[model samples]
Target chain A: MSMEGSIGQDGGSENWGPQVTRKSLMRGGLAALLVAPWTASTLGAGGGRESGGQDAEASGRTRGAGVTDDEIVLGVSAAFSGPSRGLGAELYRGATAYFNHVNANGGIEGRRITLKLYDDGYQPDPCVQNTMRLMLEDKVFLLFGYVGTPTVTRVLPILKKFQNEDIFLFFPFTGAQPQREPPYGDFAFNLRASYNQETAGLVDNLIRIGKRRIAVFYQIDAYGRSGWAGVRAALQKHGEKLAGEATYSRGEKFTGSMRKQVEILQGVSPDAVICIGAYAACAGFARDAVDLGLDVPIANLSFVGSENLLKLLTEGREDAGKYTRQLINSQVVPSYEDTSIPAVREYRELMARHDPQVPEELTREEYTPFAHSFGSLEGFLNARLLAEILRRLGPNPDRAGLEEAVFSVRDFDLGISEKVSFGPDRRQGLQSVYHTVVEEGRFVPLDDWGARFA
Target chain B: MSSASSGVRIRRLFQKTRFGIFAVFGLIVLSTSILCIYTVDTELTAEYEINIQNIAKTIADSSVGILLNRDLATLQSLVDQFLDVQGIEYIYITSESGEFLAHTFVPGIPEEILASDHGSTEPVERSLPGMGDFIEVGSPILAGVAGTAHVGMDLDVVALKIQRAIGQQVYLISVILVLGVLASIWFVNLAAKPLAELLAYAVELARDGEREDLADREILSRDDEAGHLARLFLHVARQGAGRGPAPGVGGRE
Candidate 1:
């Protein structure tokens, strides 16, 4: 068929013509001019991009750069679209809500805080991309509430390049040791407990309980290596070595890995097993141990938080209950289930006001208050500490002034945890651990063993 | 007899004039009407998709906070609140193990929908206020605790919003189409007046056999296909009236 004929047959040609008159064309052109602006205005109204009637001063309070009149911009990068997207989103929500509350209450010292968030997708490449964008494009004054171990590691070089630039990388979600170390590290602060501290705390309680033979299951990454080193160092005090050790890849299905680890553990017949991965793997290991008839008590670091583990164990409730009766866990942060603590009360209240849909009851079945979220409270504490330091800088804090202010932080106490002390040698404040055992499917504290490892 | 012939010729001329005017007006009106309808439909569809996406992002962010806080009650309450949101049809919160934690609708979601590994199982994405398919946000609880908190939102409300937007555009386009048709008809009639006058002059020349005076004149000056057709018609009339053949007559035939 001819091109025009085919086009006409297709019904599109009906929309065009050679018979159009000059007069009608003029009318159509005028109509287009009149319609174009009206359509654009309607679209702008419907799309919600036009911030009509919103106070510019209030909006400016969010986008302001570098300690402006009534606002401070903070940068954040987290995995908002990958496997860790859930955790990243949660952390962002918690931090954002808290900031919103603070902003609503006239902000910190007359300056409202705004968070510039970028999604890293839980990968190193995206982490670097997002970090650079936030630092260069957004020109945020400081970085805060970043999550993930590899992502933090990937961004270290870029962060170092910006070291002399006077930007602070504060309260990254990961507790990796290098983030707290020198040369490659300095200026970066962590709110979570170091793996060494967590593992040492786990070993300390194990030694006290008279469980000598222990096997460690780790994820073979920076997170795992740090915990393993701490475990070995803590065991060395008693002149002992791990009974057996196994490592697995992150995000691997735990069924086969758990079976293989159980077999290896069976050879050593350790009195206890320490898992240093996520709760899903821990649950898999617990289930496999039961199937293998290895009724040894299982212990895990803070990474295997209670909420996720409980949910996983609840899947095979009857069998899991029998095997996990003596399951124990070490925590670096206060338990959300512990209502008596001031931090827990504040956390509950904050959740209520900012996110009314979240449950008020802090139960083991519903909530997992691990070092990450708990550590975020540490971020809250750090933000407060930084605000104080900014105030002490007396109006305009330079890089050197902020540095001196941080070093002078001594015995600053927040209600949830113990006193935080920072000096020349000690940058990480409040090194403490809480020991708990599962009783009726919940972690119950065994002793007042806070800061025993420290 | 000549008077009767004149009456018959007038009747024929009137019929031809009416038919020609109507055909030209119809073509112009139909073309303008069709163009307006097509453009408006395309624009409205694009707007609907954008609205759905924005709403989805907002709902996803809010649900993430609930999971992180480990507030199951709050998570449940949020699911309920989502149902009331302008474009949401259904919302569900589930564990990683495929257990329903909370939902806005009472009818239980199929286990397959919760556990299906199909990538398309993710709800159809739309860009409407409070409209989107299901989005799952899983937060790991306590250090050893392994479970996912999943939130699912239905996009029916978003679909409805899209329909409403399209409907509004359709109405507006219909109004424009009607006005465009009327304007096109008026314009075609005005343009056809000169052509009708030319046809009358040709008829007068044919009757009086005054071919000598028409030798230097042509119907249309521009060298276009339409001009060519007008020239052909005038040449044919002159030749058919027993006038000498035109210079391009052999080639044209």
Candidate 2:
């Protein structure tokens, strides 16, 4: 396995050195040192760099921060620890696998892509600190692959605060609306569908199958609330409402009991329950709901990390099918098992080839990496779309042209069934949401929701 | 005066003086201990209440903008960090419409909080059924338009601190009382020794009428008031002895 060098925000590498270095790299190092103090002052907390103005002018080109002649360093702050670690770890693997393939094939216009990674543990404050470090200390070209809604929502303000520095967050792995709405929407380019779209599709399909009384079990944060709002709106369209609701805190582990939440939702006799939480909590809820005999269909959003959720539910269980029965998960990315899709075939091939590991320093907990997951597939597509944008930026890429380049991409095919398109009004690339169910120990796309669920 | 009776007189004086010292020191210790315990309990309880309220205010002030924007996620993050302060058991925020915006409850928002008065600006001390006592304080964000922030400080922790403080005060006061008793006993003995000896000498002289001299010269050295009085009495006694009972000789005269 070829390991790519990951530079931390402290200008240090994670045991792996960049194999691609240009003659100007030493000067770039010097320029970074001269640029650090100024960037540190301008961007106090979650601030961005202004770039070395005289240096860029001297070169007669608008050189962005974190971009040398030979490489572009992007920042990634996600949950590499805690209950959501699988999401972060797998997402990084997926993105890096694609990037590794790109770099191996003589790089993008002879410049290799590197990630300056930090662990936010799926928290907001640490995410904010990581963003500030990435922007000011590491001077990353842009922020990419931020994992959760809470972390990304907090980072949005920082992105807006440093918008003058031309810092944009690309394809965060959340379906939450904060990065999709106004005031903060312009700062992020999302590749995944919103939670509203996911919940609305779930609710709409469930309603079509006569499951009108829907209840929600959410993770009591912006992510949960976004899904809750989506469910509510979707139910209102059919002249119905949530039968009941329950919430759990973020960072709740799978071992923690969800009996109380189960009892709360069970009392209302909801026909179906939609969970908008991380894998651990959602799995716990599903386990307890089954153990307590709450016989109803349980649906989850894509953010749940469906593979990890199923793994927790079925791991060490004598009756795995009993727990996994009637479980539905909504996803923004197509199933990785569907190799008929060009991207899926490419993703599976590259994931096997690169097998990128979460940097050793970020792996605070022991996690067995999945060979292929929806999370990494989305990450692969994110990296693919970013590479396309960077390619469109031509041989000389600057942060100033990033937004225009992203917008200029119209009807771009990511080798998936859904065509990705972006414009001045549209910040999100893909708007389609797919639903799936467990079939033979894996999530397969549910072609006929009414037939299977009914 | 007979020596045996003189010794008895000194013993009686010592007993009386020691009893008086014990009584006085015992009362002082009891009163001081009560005062200290009261002071500690009152001060600690007041400080804890003030600290919790200040924390609630700080959270509310920081949450105003996030709440106004209706960013429940950031508002939750804002309130969640304050839980690290010791004794801060829970925190919750409400929107201007009196709906729950964010809270730090694990299972769910307790019905006690849901039913409690969000309109109250005053801090209310509550006994949550299973969660123990709390001094629930609220602060209005943006003059209550952005809604209210409530912080529940665990009163059990405050009570435990106060108990520890009071226990330490009692220990200190008890030690002081014991030391006071010991020093009082020694001081009383030192002060009453001369008087006790003088009384014994008088008793002897009343019984014997005369002696060659004061037996204990340390008490009759004519250096201070006790010495001068002892010497003067001895001289008068010798003179009277020389005059041989002028007023009432033998029986009644």
- Model 2, residue A51: C-alpha shift (Å): 26
> TM-score of the A chain in candidate 1?
0.75
Candidate with best TM-score: 2
lDDT of 1 by residue, A1-454 (tens): 0000011011111111122233543453322211111111000000111321112333333322344454455667765543334455445545544554565666666655545555555555556666655555445667887876656765675677667777777767666666677544576766557777887777877777677887787654445545655677689888888876765655443444478667767877887778876656777787788888888777777655455565567655665467566567777677767778785666556655655111111111233333324334444444555555556655554555656676777777656657777766777766877767666766677664323211
| N/CA/C clash count, model 1 | 28
What range of 10 consecutive residues in model 1 chain B has the weakest lDDT sum?
B1-10
Reference-based TM-score of each model: 0.51, 0.82
| Per-residue alpha-carbon lDDT of candidate 2 for residues A1-454, written as tens digits (9 for 90 to 100) | 1243332234432112232233333333322223222122111111112221112222122246767665666888888889999999889889988988887886678666767777888987778767776776567788999999888988898888778989999999998777887768899999999988999999999998989989999987778877877888799899998898899989999999999999988888998999989999999999899999998899999999999999998888687787888899999998898888999999999999888887666676799999999999999999999999989888888899999999999999999988889988899999999999998788988888778867
TM-score quality measure for candidate 1: 0.51
- TM-score for chain B in model 1: 0.45
- Cα lDDT tens digits, model 1, B158-177, are 34655576567656656765
Q: Write the per-residue lDDT of candidate 2 for residues B1-253, one digit (tens) a residue.
A: 3344346434565787778777887788788878988999899988987888788889889987666565555666567678879899988888777777777776666778878888566989888776888888888888887788888989889889998998898888789878987887778767666676676666666767555544445566435565556656665676677844322222321
User: What overall lDDT, based on C-alpha atoms, would model 1 receive against the true structure?
Assistant: 0.54
